[model samples]
Target: MTAAGMRARGNVRTLVLAGALVTVTAALGMVGCTLFQSEQVSKGQKLYAHYCMHCHGEHGQQNEGYNWGQMPDPRPKDLSNKGEMSTFKDEEIFGTISRDMKDTTPEVGDKIGDDEFAVPTMPTFKYTLSEEEIWSIVAYVRTLHGMKLTYNVEARKKELQDQLQTAQQKADQAKQALEAADKKAEDEAEKKGVEVDEAATAKEQEANVAAIKELEAGKTAFANFTARPKLAAVPRPDLTMAETEAAKLAETGKRLYGNKYGCNACHRVGEAGGLVGPALDRAGFRLNGTWVYRWIKYPQSMKPETRMPNLGISDQDAKAITMYLATLRAPKPEKPIEKAAH
Candidate 1:
């Protein structure tokens, strides 16, 4: 072969190899992006259900149960509105969702109040979620609005960690300042030949303690939020009932108690339940079936300001639940010991 021909063939081979490498890299990049997006959207859907759907509606239509009566005045924004969502940038949506009342610059000597209201106008997820998680929610929101936005999962995670660290630093500084102020107040009272207001001092100390506790709780909650621990499956409660017509109904009530009614979420029956409501350790001894039935059916009729929501319990379900509850009786008290007369 001629030298010129050999050189030409070598040049063509080099170009072909480079082209293949480029193609493979581009394909791999595309695959990675697709996978990342899919995972984020899935996370976003779960987060939305857990957080946003209560106010925004299931499908973002603002037609949910809460939107009608439970939500505050100037009801939650209609996220389903394509035109309205179109105006805001992705960052703007994120800011709106995560911004808290205390994000503003505090005046000199003003403490950052960490206590969130029982029911906020628009609750901030900054305390609950990291930046990555919030962006995942944003990505999901985009899907609802019929748009595809790119999300960088790793970069957002780093940003979120940095933000959390900054918040911790601020909390630490606030706590230290409060401690110093409390000590200074005590010292000043001692130096001054005046009576110290014990009540006011005690109240101030209580506030400082609460602030410290809240900060610690916030850190623990955020850690748990990031961990995303798997929830344990609930075991069926073994309920005992007397041999009566109501007892027959209690069987169905037992299932309803554990599953649909979500009574177990608040009321503790045994080892497994929340502490939101009074434990039914011996509810039967305290009240009769008739009263229990009325309370279950129309709780508001009895106490207007009850924390328990009117679940619109059907007559049969309420009766069944009442029967089941009536079976619960407190243990008999033991006799007290007599003291010897001196």
Candidate 2:
């Protein structure tokens, strides 16, 4: 063979090998991508196996109370019906697992804003896993079946969007209607020659000013005057962590909570108080101390229209309060928060 022919043959052999190698690498890369995204059911199941399976049951059929945590049902929610759960959109189920429904507000049913979980035992998982991991868990949970749901989320969102549009249109119409009515009223007033009696108006104004002054006088807690709450003391609103007490801060807390703050006016310690607030013997166990502290520091912050007046507690005072309450840990576990009155 000629020298050129030999070199050409070698070059073709090298090109063929390189092409085969490239094809092999591409095939492996595609396989790797597929595994990474592979609907991830197993990865999800494994994640659930690590975090949820113990209480939720191996197959989600376990019905047992918590060992350390106190729960009314003790048993975790069962999530085994495809037909039933099919009603929930991926978003809601994702919510249940990821959002820690217990951390949710009790009045509204499962709000993170509430003390993290209405069910005292459930821990909030907000910090533990990523969103993708949570979604994968939701997909795995979908495999479980039985409870019925009313509406899938996509449908609900659409329904809500439609309702919002309708409401906006109605609001616009009502505003226009109100403007027309107000214009008519003004026109009628002008025609009627509306007039005021100055002497009578002056008397009415004086009466209103006197009444406001009386109200103001009633609210002021003057030194040495022992201002009485016009309304009888109310049941304290659910307090925040700032509202509670812990061990270390108990000494100063005893003084402030008892005397200056007048907490004992409603709350009781050892037989030296009133029945307005819940007994504080085991306050720490009753509600999470953290929540109590929050309640104390800013009770009204939790429920804007709450009966409890803002006590104007400072942050330092709140910390001391939590420290004292921690000293009030229950000798034993409290009975599961009574199906907490809705």
Say which candidate scores most in TM-score. 1
Residue 24 displacement in candidate 1 (angstroms): 1.5
- For every model shown, the clashing-pair count is 0, 42
Model 1 residue runs over 4 Å out of place are 65-69, 102-119, 150-153, 158-342
TM-scores of the candidates in the order shown: 0.43, 0.33
User: Residues 21-112, candidate 1, lDDT per residue (tens digit)?
Assistant: 99999999999989989898899889887666655657777645242333324346677678888877887777766654221212421244
Cα lDDT of model 1 overall?
A: 0.62
Q: When superposed on Cα atoms, how far off is each prediction in RMSD? A: 18.4, 19.6
Candidate 1, residue 323: how far the Cα is off, in Å: 35
Instruction: Report the lDDT of model 2 for residue 331.
Output: 62
Lowest lDDT 10-residue stretch of candidate 1: 101-110
lDDT of each: 0.62, 0.52
